[model samples]
Target: MRVTAVRTTRAPAWQWAGCAALVLLGAVIPVLRFLVFWPMDQWQVDVEVYRQAGVSILIGRPIYDAMTEAPQLLPFTYPPFAALLAIPLALLPFGLVGWLWTALQIAATTAIVWYAGYRLIHRGGSAQPLVLGLLAAPMFWLHPVGDGIRFGQVNAFIVLAALMDLRRPRPRVLSGVAPGVLVGLAMAIKLTPGVFVVHYVINRRWREAGTAIATAAIAWLAAFVAIPSASLAFWGGALQDPARLGPNMGTSNQSIRGVLMRVGPSGGAGVALWLVLIALVGWFGFRLARRAWLRGDTVTEVAAVGLLACLLSPVAWIHHFHWIVVAILAILGADPLRDRRRLVAALVITVWFVCRLPWWGISWIAHDWPPILVGRILQNADLAGALLALWLLAWASAREPRDAEADAVARAGERSAAPGKVERRAASEAG
Candidate 1:
C-alpha cells in the first residue's frame, strides 16, 4: 500500500491584507484623536521642549538655556545629540510638527510590536502577519504606549532601538561592532539605554561593549565640538542633578528608587535601601540573562536586560515602562502549556498594567487612605511587576532544557526502544 502526504494550505493574501489594515487602523485612530481633539496646552509638551532645543541649536542660542513657555519652563533633559536629532521638528510650524511627531510615534510603537512578535512568536511561516496584528492590537492599549504617544515621549523609539540591537544578526565585516553602534546611538539620545552596555559586559561581548563606549564617546565628542559650552554645562553640572529630571517620588516615577523614596526611608536610609534593591535586582537579572544567552533564548535575554534598565534607573517614568512589552512577550513566549501558573501570573500582571491600576488605585484612595498604605501600594506596582517578571524569567530559564542534554535524552530513549522494535519485527516475520 502507498500513502499520500498531505500539504497544508497557507493563509490567503487577503487575510494578511486584512491584518495589515487592522493594525494600521488600530495605530492611527488614537493618534488622530490626540492630535485633533486634545487641548493645545496638553499637546505633547515634551516635543515642544525638544523642538525648542533644536531651534536653539540652529539659531546659536544655548540649548539648555532655552525653556518651554511659561508655567512649566521645562528645559531639555536629553543628551546634546538628541537636540541635534530634533532639528527637523524645530524647523516646522508647531501644528505641523505635532501632527508629524504623533505619526512618527505611532509608527515607532507599531515597529516595536512587530519586532516583539517577530522575536517572540513568529516562526518563519505564513502566520507572521496574523501574529503581528494580534500583538499590535493589545499593545496599543498598553498604558506605556498610550502615555508615550500622549507625551510625545521617546520611549517607543528607545525600545525599538534596543530591540533592533538585540535582534540584529552578527555582521560579516565588523561582526560585533554593529550591535554596539545601535546601542551607542540609542544611548546618545538618552542615557538610560546605556544600561544595555552593561548587558554586553555581562555576556562577555567585550568588542561590542568597547565599541558601544567608543561610539558614545565619538557622538558626545561631535556634540561637544558643535556646542562646547552647552556640552560642558550639561555634562559637568546638569547631568549630576537628579532633581533636574523631575520629582522622583511622583507616581509617574516607577523605578525601585521611586518606591523607596515614597515608603522605605529618607536621606541615607533611603539611599541604602535603594542600593540594596539595585544590587539584588542586578545580580538576579544579569544571571538570568546570562543563562538565557547560554540556552540561546533571545526573548528572555531581551526581557531581562530591559527590566534591569527600568528598575535600576533613578527615574523610570510610566512611559519608560514600555520595556514591559518585552517582559510580556517573554512570558508569552515561554512554554505556556508546561508553565500554566507563570502564564496566568503574567496575564494578571499585564492586565494590571493595561488598566493602569497603580495610578488609578492611588487616585481613588488619595482622599480616603493612609499615606503609608497608599504610597506602598501605588509606588511599588510596576516595580513589583518587574520583580515578579524577573523571578519568573529566572525560573523558566533554569528549567529550560539544554540542547546537549535534550539530545542525549532523545538518543537514550531511541536506544531503549530499539529492542522492542526488533522483537516485534521478528514476530511479524515468523508469523
Candidate 2:
C-alpha cells in the first residue's frame, strides 16, 4: 500500500493578472485620497479621537479620561484593552502614526484576501479563474475593506482572526488561541467584535470560546488594575450609555436600528422591533450553521456563519461588514462561477458599494429639491442599503453545504464510541 499527500495547485497567468489587478486597486486607494473633496474636518473626527486616546495612554492620564470634556465624546465606545493595543503606535508622532497604522491595515487586508484565496484554492481544487474570482470577489473589494481603509479602521484584523479559525482541526486547543487573542483585542478596541464571541459559543466551539472569554478577561483585568477609577467610571455610566447613544437601528447608525428609525421614530417600539428582528436572524443563522455542519460543509461555511451574525446584529456599521470578504472567499473555495448561486452572490457583493455612492455624491448633487427632503431620501437609501446587505447574507447562508471536515470528525467520534476502541482513544488522549 502507498500513501499520498494532496497539494492544491496554482492558477494560470490570466488569473495571476486578476489577482494583481485587485491588489493594485487595494494598494492605490490610500494614495488616491487627495483627489476626493470631502470635508477634511469630518475625516479628523474618528482619527483625532484615537490619536488623543493614544496620547492620553502615553501620558499618565487614565485610559478613559475624556479626550473631550464630555464623557460620551470619546469618538467610540470600547473596552480598556483597546487603549493598550494602541500603545505602541502612541510612541510615534500622530502624522507618522496614522500613516503607518493605515499602511499596516492595508497590508493586513491584502494578506487576508491572499490567504482567503489560498484557502479557497486549497479546498476547491479547481481552475485559476475560480481562484481569481475568489481573490477578487466584489464583496472582498468593496464595502468593508473600502470604507474601513478609507476611515483608517482596524476591522481587517478582526477579519483575519475569524478566517484563521475556520475549519480548524478538532482538538485544536492551541489553534484556537491566536484567534481568541485577536477576538479579545478586537473587542477591546470596539464592542462590536464581542458579538463574534457569542457566535462562537453558539457554534459549540467551546475551547476557542473559553479562550476568547479568558483572554478578554485577562486583558480587561490588566487595564482595570492599571486604571481602577476609569474602569469604575465606565461601568458606572455603562447602564445609561446605550439610551444616551440612541438606538443603532436609526439611519444615523447604519444598523438595523437605523433602518427602523428611518421608517419611524427610534423610540421604544423601534427598539422592540429591533430585538425581535435580531432574534429571528439569530435563529435562522443557527439553523443554517447546523444544516451546513451536519451536511458536511467545509471550513469556509464558518465565514458564511460570520456574515449571518453581522447582519443579525442591531448595530453593524458599513465598515463592520468587512467580514464579508472572508465569506465570499469561503463560497468561492466551495464552488466557482459554474455555481450560479455563487456567481450571483459575487455580483451582489460587487454592487454593494453603490449604496455609499449617494452619500459620496450628496455634496456634488446640488439639486433643486428641498434640503430636508434630500436628507430624508438619503436616510431612506441607507435603510434600503442595510436591508440589501442582510438579504445577501441570507442568500449565502442557504447555498450548498460544505462541511467535509466536520463530518469526518463526527465519523471519527462515532468510531471512538465503538467497543474495543480503547487504543484509538488512548492515542488521541496522548496527543
TM-score of each: 0.84, 0.74
What TM-score, to 2 decimals, does candidate 1 have? Answer: 0.84
Clashing pairs in 1: none
lDDT of 1 by residue, 237-265 (tens): 88998887788888788899987887788
* lDDT on C-alpha atoms for all candidate structures: 0.72, 0.55
- Candidate 2 lDDT tens digits, 238-287: 42466433455443455555556656556698778888877776676566
RMSD of each: 9.2, 7.1
The most accurate candidate by TM-score is 1
Worst-scoring 10-residue span by lDDT in model 2:
422-431
